[model samples]
Target: MPSSAGPSIDTITEGGRVTQVGEGQEAEESVPPVMTFGAPTAGEILAERYELVEHINNDSAGRLVWRGVDVVLRRPVAVVLRYPGGDSATEMLQAAVAASRVIHPNLVGVYDAIDEAERAYVVREWVDGQSLREMVADGPLDPGRATAIGNAAASALAAVHATGMVHGNMHPGTVMISQEGRVVLADARTDGADSRENDVRAVGGILYFALTGHWPHAEAPLRGATAGHGRAAIPDGVRDASGAIAAPRQVRAGVPAYLDDLTMDLLDAGIAPPPSDVLAAELGRLDIPIEEEPYPEPAGPLRFAAETGDEPSPLASVGGRKVAIGIAGLLAVALVGLLIGISALGGDDDPLQTEPVARPSSSAPASGAAPAAATRKLSVSDVRIIDPDSKLRDELGGAERVTDGDQDKGWDTDTYTQPNFGNRKSGMGVWIDLGEEHTVKSVQVSLSATGASAQLFAGKTDPPSTSAGDKLLFTSYRTNPVGQPFEEHDGTTMTFNGFDADAKYRFLLFWLTALPSNDRGYQVGVLEITVQGS
Candidate 1:
């Protein structure tokens, strides 16, 4: 029998097997949940080995974090409520194993998992600081700090997704700022979202909140790099088609447009790249670039390029003061050529009607020859100027492909999907409730090169076989431009034939070569994905 201190009497029970005691029955002490939030105000202390310190914020599923103790250890330890829906001992182990693989500095590290009498308990490093939400409650951050935080957060997401896992619950509140001002994800959740895209959208939400100080602009665009209603399902702050923001200029003048654009990509790239790391890198190139043109001779008389005062070329410079010099001669030649073009243009009476009818200057050399090599413009698809892969992966909650197998194309939550891939990660996922399976001769595919960079392979195999990998149907993608960046939001599809769609392969394959720096990849919402029958 256990003794009680006051009104709260704690008790202990076993698996029953109690023996009969002769005439000695007494009231037992009642046991609390064995945990309390923050400090224990006036609750019953069943065991005096530990004390409650402070409470952390609430979780998405209403779970809470408390600063608690091992009276034995006397050290600060973060204690989280048991995660529900894990069903049994096995699920608890799976969730724990998946989380343990991630090793990143920016990510909150899990110390241990405790399964106490059917309830799961998680203990993590105690971060003695406020959350980003609390800090931003007053107002948005200055540009520099905001950009730094964004860069760091993006890095955390990148590390997580690279392991082939999702943070399931990444948001502002989930980000904790250490006493030293380092931001770490509160918890790397895996218990939510059937697909990885949910995490992507949530990442956008975090950066928006971080920069704007509020969630008023929470809706960042989804993964495509285009502008239209076909891909218009993005949240508010994102502009149409392009994964661009609502132009930071609107939020505050002198705001870096490059930062705004990158913020949009990072927010939109979920699990592909954390926006924080991306922002940090973009901040380096964040200055307003000074564009220059080839030296334009001043537009005054032909002597402007040479004169200091209202003077002439060195032609006006004579021997020392007005001699014909380099700039002066070049100016004179351009002036004469301008006179000829002006004459050919019929003299501005008709600006649009000026026809280029001259084949001339053959005696003056060919002017139509292409100038020396032009500077190559970096597109959205190939801009590796600020590659944040290494930095982003530093936080480490990346996704990992656990199961890879080939089977008949039927909906099997238990059946794993894997394809013959090359130089990258490849697989297809969908939420399918296939009723009566029918023959599938053709399949529709939406291969996203924006969020998750990948190649799509479509082939028909006799008996619908993926075995021996001999059945080669059709492959689409630039072998050379595999993960190169492009300047547009677009996608492509491939078709295969010469085999039986009878194997029920209405669904196709997704070969993820590289995730967008934002952690973009293949994902399907409840209604967005479907497996059809022929």
Candidate 2:
């Protein structure tokens, strides 16, 4: 039988006995050696520079984390190693390189990424404290403390997004709190799989986990999750029948209202996630600043001798003068009051002369005389995704297609189980920026199928969500149905007329309510959009 040893070490079997082989030792046993795999041990130097000191833990991505030392630089470092290197090292190397480019106080520093044929590893800053995961494991964190950690993470993400990169993997496990109370985000896995919006949501998730001790993104693969496998096991977010996850406050007590709102907004898939920089600024404002304790007040009053003076002592002279002036001021005020009373009595006999009140000037037109402003063609740019159904379709359509005068190609929605987006959402629509606010008279749409219902919404700002059309632009529902359905052969030409012509409008939404097809998975295609305004 052959003795088993780690991949980093060599071993030999000597006649039914297993013996470990040291460096520069020839195999005395005639038996062949068996190969086994394990992590690098102490005194093992990787790439002839990093010496493994001790096993810290395992990362969520099935990587072993070790506390190591850079032999050349003589500095402490944390090394994350993955086995069977070569192809497996691709993502690890890519993540390391991307993270290394961003230098931020809230981001963990990356030193090197190396592959040694048998294994691949990333060397980074060694944080000598617990992960957010470890802290929350004991119990929930204080709301103020959680907010600070969130602010740091968001600020770090803003830096990452500024470079047009996304930190695809953001969980409590990745958030490190050093012994010095420094918050840093580690391990940015940019697989091009998750978008920048996911990064923002992850910050909210972190706060939720810190407060409620529950992971809102339940499917997240966390470190110490499985026994002797990955990292810690993160608890899943609680969801109701509609699949809507409850807010952090609903899950746990002591969560502040402001924090609850912020967390909920980030987690809301319906609304567009606020930009990273904007979110960072908001979090910054909410972060409670550390206050120093105030100095204790003196117990006794000062006892200072008055200076000998040809001129009186400054303090005594000033105090005496102030008292005399105060008495004189009171007498003068009484005399003035008597004179004012006498004048008012005399004015009562004659008509009191008064200045007229002035009215402020106004720029708005008088009632019922508002002119119908001249209209011009508006460009349809700044198209954005507003999928109410939460369908993850990146290639829905562009705003250019609707105004490009191309009947051949236009934007369409993904196939849905039901006609109305499976009742998961109120509706879906494409937003058209009119460049500036206008008096939108009407909008006409050409659809591929008949009887497709839609609405025209005009607003100043982009609609927060698909179902949120009612919240902005107009107080009531904006879903004004198009004209009667036409035959399939002729296609449908529906016009949305009679908009609030006096009301200012900038962003117009053509929201679809019902699909025309009776198929199992149905979708609607808008070929062209004609805007008539004045």
Number of backbone collisions per candidate: 67, 6
Model 1, range 1-534, lDDT digits (tens) per residue? 111100000011113211110000111122122233332332222144435565433321233345566566666555444333234333433454455555566665444554543344444445455556556666766556565565555555555555665554344444556667766653343443322434433544565555665442333221211232111222234243543344343455543433443344333221122122222333322322223332111111110011112232211111221111111011000111100000000001210011111111121213684322211111111100111122222211211111111111222111112221122223222211123344422222223223333332322222222222211211321121111131222322222222232243322332333333223322311111112223
Q: TM-score for model 1? A: 0.38
Q: Count backbone overlaps in model 2.
A: 6
Q: Can you give the lDDT of residue 296 in candidate 1?
A: 19
Model 2, position 525: C-alpha lDDT score: 80
Q: Who wins the TM-score comparison?
A: 2
After superposition, candidate 2 runs with Cα above 4 Å error: 1-41, 57-64, 82-91, 219-232, 236-243, 251-254, 290-435, 438-534
Error of 1 at 352 (Å): 65
143-176, model 2: which lDDT tens digit per residue? 7788789888778777767767666556665566
